[model samples]
Target: MSETKQSGSPELQWVRILDLDELPEGRVQTVTAGTTSLAITHYQGKYTALDNRCPHQGGPLGEGSIENGWLRCPWHGWDFCPHTGKPPGGYDDGVPTFPVETREDGIYVGLEAKPPRIRTVSDVMVETMTQWGVTHVFGMVGHSNLGFADAMREAERAGKLTFIGIRHEGAAAFAASAYAKLTGRPAACFAIAGPGATNLLTGLWDAKVDRAPILALTGQVDTQVLGPGAFQEVDLATAFNGVAEWSQTVLPSSRHAELMSLALKNAMIKRDVAHLILPNEVQEMPAEGKPATTPEGRVTPMEITPPAASVEAMLKLLRTSKRPVIVVGHGARFHMAPIVQLAEQLNAPVVTTFKAKGQISDHHPLGCGVLGRSGTPIASWFMNESDLLLVFGASFSNHTGITPKKPIIQVDYDAMALGKFHKVAVPVWGEIGITANLIRNELGAIDTVDQRPEVRARWAIWREEKLRREKDDRGRGINSASVFAAMNRVIPENAVIAVDVGNNTYSFGRYFECTRQSVLMSGYLGSIGFGYPAAIGAHCAAPDRPTICVSGDGGFGQYLGELTTAVKYGMNITHVLLNNNELGKISKEQRADELEVWQTSLHNPSFARYAENCGALGVEVTEKARLDECLERALAHEGPALVEVRADALLV
Candidate 1:
């Protein structure tokens, strides 16, 4: 029997614990009564309920075995009266009781109403995160991070942030890194103390190497149990030593707001990972009325103009040169407009580093394609012919293969990146857009070579070569040229493409002609399995734009489970999976090194069927003729969709 509160008895709440048939008869089960856990016992064909904890040692009584007409505690084998929860004969200790009733639809448990939420340390830190424009969070919630997860829940409910629960911590980190890469803002990746924290290393390394800002929030064991090798405890600070620019532990004595401020500031200024450790004990501590921190005045404008001396030298070089070329990289993505305008003014052919493939459209009059191993002949021809190279934000990485022999002017915001590998003719320490604008404003019309006609001729020659390659089929698999040709026509102009490493990525660089699209990649790290996870991140960063993932079968297998992540969020991503059934890049490299292609083959499954199983639209294309039609259909679908294009392993 239960009594209803007569309008004043501590405002009550009705909570449905379980469906009527959820629990088997004569079984004891635990249910929540408001925030209090209750031991609901049903034995001898009658329902009885009490505290779920054993009074003796706080062992869970619901988990105890029912033996000889009494419930036996599993921890100490202590017995209690099954019906009234009274102890066996003269023992006063027993579980407390609460009123419960069986409704037609479900079981309901009654207890005092829950109290209003109290501000916690995690709340303060999370509030600081929201205040700093951390809109997207990707990670897995585990045992040690419960208190902090609850705070995130509250924030999500309040519409202050978005939390995506991922299957693997690695995917979470990659998603966060990709978000940062696309938006130039920090996104958080959460994990538990030990293995979870370590799983983030690869993706975090991607962010660190590429100079993208990322935040890591990790949970730890209780403060008291930190030392002496407690479960899930590792030296996280030392573990993240190389990756994070700022790593700190949140303690009860810590100035919660200030801790967050430092972490965020370091992440923004250095474009590095910032980490905060939350001890299990400290995460739930009451905030004591402290306010959260924000990014107001913490960030300064990053538009540094080139020094006058460097500008004059660069102008002199450009003016004297017969052929001038502009080479932009991934770091110049945000400031591409002015760079393109400068190219137009100079009539200079614009060739991009592989990472900066889409910054300059292939359709532009002065735009050449990617330059390097994954590059086109057009870019190579121009770079080889140019007398002066105006490099903006292009890291002199070996992959891009920028020639040090050429007379070059390199511009970057980071002074350390200037002449990082070798001496340049002019190392301008300034923001790329600002420097471009400054040079454009300062320069007068000079007699310089107009490379526009040559640019068009080179593009025409390359397109013919690409078309010829598209038709060279051994009947072993579909050629990559055909695949990209189809995608170039069908995919949206405003699409954000996330490309993975391997032959697929190389082909994308060489064959795909971009027009008004943005490309995201694991640039410096060159990590595989970055495509799909990065798609999730890019979609979150720009929900209005169409998100696409381009990956080979070898790379996609690394994080195939992320398809479910895309499905769960209803991300409108069209994944173009190149299924070659082998690591074609490795095989080709083996051939080049005069070594046997050992262990380069991969066993595969039908990825399209897998996508269908995950509640996404899936289409498999074995015929070269189906590329355009199939991709068009998948891209038209509003949600997550995948098209597995069977390609020849040798064709790429």
Candidate 2:
């Protein structure tokens, strides 16, 4: 490590090292100044520096990985700001960050004290956020959180952070969720008490399900009026218990930075949302101590230790079973090499859950596509015939593999997920340990049952046959199959696809063949309105790649306001609305259940017109002949665009 800056000013004295070109993208390099160490990262042609230690347990920051603008500590995946050394959400204390100056020859870091002012609680709140790397806040304003909302406005004007207002609390939560997922950090959201908190539940659940970090701040009644059945005074602590990883009520006139710090640390450490119930009185409180700075040092990486006996048992079982099958999930995604090696070692067919669709390419000889109700017939057949099943890194949700009479070996990071929905004969927990054990230990080789060679060949033939059939399945008029094929042709190979829940989702699953895996869906949650915001998130995550959202008219209407968010961020996602003039899935389900389908039918708006109103390029395709042109136009547009494809009311 080298130092460059030499100054006598205690606040401004710092040092510089390596030229800007030396820092690699998505990787952080450590530099030292006196006894202080810092992690420096370069993103989108900008250099940012933070104390090398995490405030939560002093994890090493240099070891953390950089994705988007957030730096995730490698040890426990705690996210922090490389710009101001502030943790996501609000933290009581932030890392000590120095001013960064870049020149043609080298980069310099300077330590400087901020000018003091008579700051309000809201002022401190915004100031704390400036230390963190967040540039925007996605939320809905209400009476309870009005002060915080006003503070956000001030922050926006001061060039500290931007505030994006949403239509509903649910939408705000969902938008924040998407933002966090895209940026790989905890995005903040504000909601009022009572109904506001309740409305945010669904989106919060979605975030928890997807493992996205978010910060939810809701206003509460003053502490002095507690248990008095005061208006809007619900037990916020109990109300948000199950919805968030950590929830707490801020006391009246309490130290704002300290409480905010606690919330941020909890969210970062737990890798989940931290809900802070701020009382009206607390929003105007004054600070007591000098605001804390970001910590310094390297984060320790997590290690998974394997159980020796369990590994040996699993290998022995794999060797004994002639027709074994491996089901890969998201856990397998993190260790792609190990998974590929295991698949090759056993010569077993590999099938993925919907979320893990492209863990291994479908073109691989032993690779089978998704396995579920929407999976390919060949994958279903493989599952039905397998003698031993090895499932990795995914919960055996009800929507996944239904059930197999054969023995199951489940490998996952969460023990609760094991044997929750299905029975598991051998369950191994932890990512690295299970994988390492399998690789190191070799059991006896069992005789290969070559009886299914012809069967396997037939399945391969069938896969190709299905693709051809899909291509030729376009009917006389506009239909789901034709729309999918058109979309497949128009979307770039690297595009990320977000499919909304409904009958349209089923059609998308059947028709869309993702060339490379960047597709996202609600998966087990099956939540409505997931498509649009998720597409925005995907675009944020990989701005270089285009993102397309396929949704039904009903699903699109739920979060249509997100168009403003896309425009604000200058994202270039293409929104495709499958206009069928009805809730297609619910209509089918009602008919099946012999119930009256009253509200299932919908009179949808002209999505093209709606998109235009939101300041994005819009196109309407009522006929199949115009789809290719419309899709092309929508995709080529500079910013967000919408393409509405009108189709029949029913799929049959």
Candidate 3:
């Protein structure tokens, strides 16, 4: 705040507004003195000041035209006296007036000392999000969410959070979902009202169905215009009804940080989408110095032991079966070592669902590769010969059919996921790692049959079949099998691979044998543009891990702009682009269903050249002979790189 001061008059507290020469005579302009905005008018060789806002809809009086000595509001044509801020009519209320004076160097406005900025609701909530370990946010900042974005900006400046501005809201959501999938923790996505908010649906559904925890922060129109259709307004809570496990709108009356606490807790405990909508005005409302919330005592330990009866049932099934096998899904990824120990105790073959493709190495003595539609003959043969299925954290999706007739003992952390589609002989609802240990403890040395020889025999048969097909190139382009063979040879043992949905993905699932790599995919949602964006998240989650992304011509085209983002961040991603110049999966489905494959073919640019234009290493592989050299170069590159392999669409 400042006070008016003149050379010949008593001095009061005064703050500089603008240089006297800056405002011409007979003109009015808006200026700021700390938090107070003023309309400084220069008329009659003197200066006067008034509040800049008009009472009529809060329009800027300074922007109004001075006609007939009256300042007319530009928004609605309301009038006020230019010097006195008095309306032309007998209106009781007008803009407030402030004292002003001229100094040698500048014009000064009279007020008290400038006040410190008030803490805001968004500030409290962003601190709470930080305390909950949500360090990364992916989204675009927009007008509706400017206040919330400002809070994030402050936190980012303070090094408490990192915000990645994205080209699309949908990509933000996918990146957040993939972050959660990779780290088993919550990351946030942000958007403005209407279309920006709605763009997050597909990725939200991806996290929801796959049981990944994610937070969505959306901006809404002012509460007053919510129902009357303000410019970008939409009922965000209603729009997110089924997708988010919990959703709420922030209000001035609400506990600001508590709302954020609940959103984070719900996402963490439920392992699903949690959302918060910040109304425009409410987001900027003063928090009055309220403290933030945290997860200090909010979360509980997740691991639990199975019931005694279920454990006994599992033991009995394991002891009696001549051929028992263990099957894990994406849900079991974090607890692989314990399950592998249990597999060794029973000499059982371990197979994975496609989503869990690289949980265990294919070279492991007991590892029988993936089991399902995108599976190998080794897994199918082992499953057919098994008498009991020791299922762990696997959802029996139709794509990965766990035979109903087999005697089964299913284990999972979520009670709802235990034999969700059908009944099992033993449904053990316990944490995966704990239950695996319990099974191993009870069956100390159960003289189980050694199935290692059979596993080796099956692997030989599958490998022989794969080799026979690898040479079946039709001369159109490189064969799918050959490309994957090159990948299996080039990618590191500890690489993280994100595969998109298409014929290329199917080939990856079928032919790319894992040594110790981890695979991430869209899984239940099976969205197309997931690979490249997910690779970004994976790189962020484990910066030291070699990250690889595989996508088809159609899938990569969807989020093609993300390549620049990879380059901007210098993410170490070796993107394997299999270009067949068509949506081969859809074409195959149409042909199999007795329909003409219409609109499935596509037009594509040279993705390798595109990557080069984006400042990344790019290699084009048209022949099988060039694949190894190209892949080696790409994987060894320091920053982001791409290997575009032209392939035969029909071979997949």
Candidate 4:
């Protein structure tokens, strides 16, 4: 294959590939014209193409997929667009983009030379991204990304876009995910080759499960020395395959626009991950084309409508049933007003999963509080006693649904999730928002009954019983309730709380209340080390907001290195270490099985000392009396801070 540079010509040129009908939705195919390899993707009634190699490490871009408008590399999960070759969310470097047009018979990609003096790949990428309305890029600096990082710095100085430096590569990915989720737009992150790419996998997995649109860029070894065991060489494509929706390696400079465009399209449209593997050597290589335009920021319209059969069936059941209960989950979080209205109309008590707490307040007249393993006993008792369960926006997993055999009217966005675990008598398929509206509209059609007075009386008794039970259990060491109450008092209402998994998550669930929807957790992945990185991401996502991370001693240590990232970025996030000094859950399980808890016992460093070593504020609280003062000091500090609270492992 020979490389072609742009000549001073205004005419457009093209390379023809497959027929329009040959492309399939949600899948990609590879095509080669002479020496240039191209990836073609068909998605949401559009077609796009990009180069076959990842810029980071020459990972095959032909294997990537297109969702929305972003093309996701199957290798390391980097994202770029096939139309403009720009990375989504204001990335500096762009992949090569070809002009794609579909005729009655076939699809054609233009091979026009971009303008001269494009300067650097990052400049071209930035120009392309600006066209897409992406204003921010989240990344960490390392040896492999020196040139691109320099370009990003220049871009930031020029006010072309904003670049937020993160301490760790993983933190960068997590921050990008949070930003994308909150804004409903694509976000980008970059990292050096080898270790940096490996470190980012944890955050990438979370994004994949949560369905966030993220573009991950990774530096790669020189393409010339690939697979010959060059320095810092590793198969990044294989490393990221499990988590990314698509992955690709950028090839030689001649094909930059094509590959980059593919990646962006995948990340944006699919609301999934796209990995772009860029070779260290090719980043400075010259390419020519007309200045690429940024994609217009367009909101994806919600198309879900309520199923008539399911809605009618559920309404009939609700009207006839005497003892009905409503169980809300994370799905209901976005439909708070309608959910509350529905609860009021039915005159029924409401219980939420831990993730869905605050969907209704604890003080609501018929609120039963959270319903789960760690939920209020009264809530659980009511769920068990109810004849029909009106499940909304929740999967009714084993963790949330203890009474699966009971008759359930499930409302969900995905119909397949309905009746998968529980006995769902009616399955309503619709967006939670729309379904809530439909239910509200139908409320007036049903016969009216003044059941609120009776329901309120029963709830009062239940609430008192729950308070008594919690009071009796207060003496238990490491009781989650005491920790929650203390935390509730100390943590400010404007704070952003990030919780890790394990018994610590369950414990935190007992007392963590959010006045607003600022709480973040790994509900889908349930990964142990998510808290620390997630906190870093949350802090980066909302710099003005006070962020707090609560993690078990075990979960905290898993991503302890992220503290250094926090320090480096000067993020103001308070990290609360629940120092049980052991893998409490595993230890408890082992003891129950009559096995010795050997490796579960961890020798932890003094957390305060570790935080101090990382150049962050540190405090230790052994007694409950010192907690308030310790937390106040930590929050008052300017940068990242850590507060380690020592507790008995047996309580978990």
- Give all candidates' CA lDDT scores: 0.89, 0.72, 0.89, 0.73
Q: For candidate 2, what's the RMSD?
A: 17.0
Query: What C-alpha lDDT, on a 0 to 100 scale, does residue 160 get in candidate 1?
Result: 96
TM-score of each: 0.94, 0.72, 0.87, 0.73
TM-score ranking of the models: 1, 3, 4, 2
Candidate 2, superposed: residue stretches over 4 Å from native: 1-136, 146-163, 179-185, 224-233, 252-271, 293-300, 331-333, 432-477, 594-597
Question: Candidate 2's residue-wise lDDT over 363-469, tens digit each?
Answer: 56677767785566767778888898888876676567646578888877666777887567888766644464465345434565542463467566765765565
Cα lDDT, model 3, residue 376: 89
TM-score of 3: 0.87
| Residue 204 miss distance in model 2 (angstroms) | 0.6
Top candidate on TM-score is: 1
List clashing residue pairs in candidate 1. Answer: 39-52, 477-648, 478-648
In the range 158-272, model 1's lDDT, one tens digit per residue, is: 9999999888899999999999998999999999999999999999999999999999999998888788999789999999999988999988899998898889889988999
Per-residue alpha-carbon lDDT of model 4 for 379-459, expressed as tens digits?
787777677788887756667754766788888876676777646688888877788778778756554444456556655
Worst 10 residues of 4 by lDDT: 1-10
Judged by whole-model lDDT over C-alpha atoms, candidate 3 comes out at 0.89
lDDT of 3 by residue, 386-447 (tens): 98999988889999877898988899999998878988999998999998887888787777
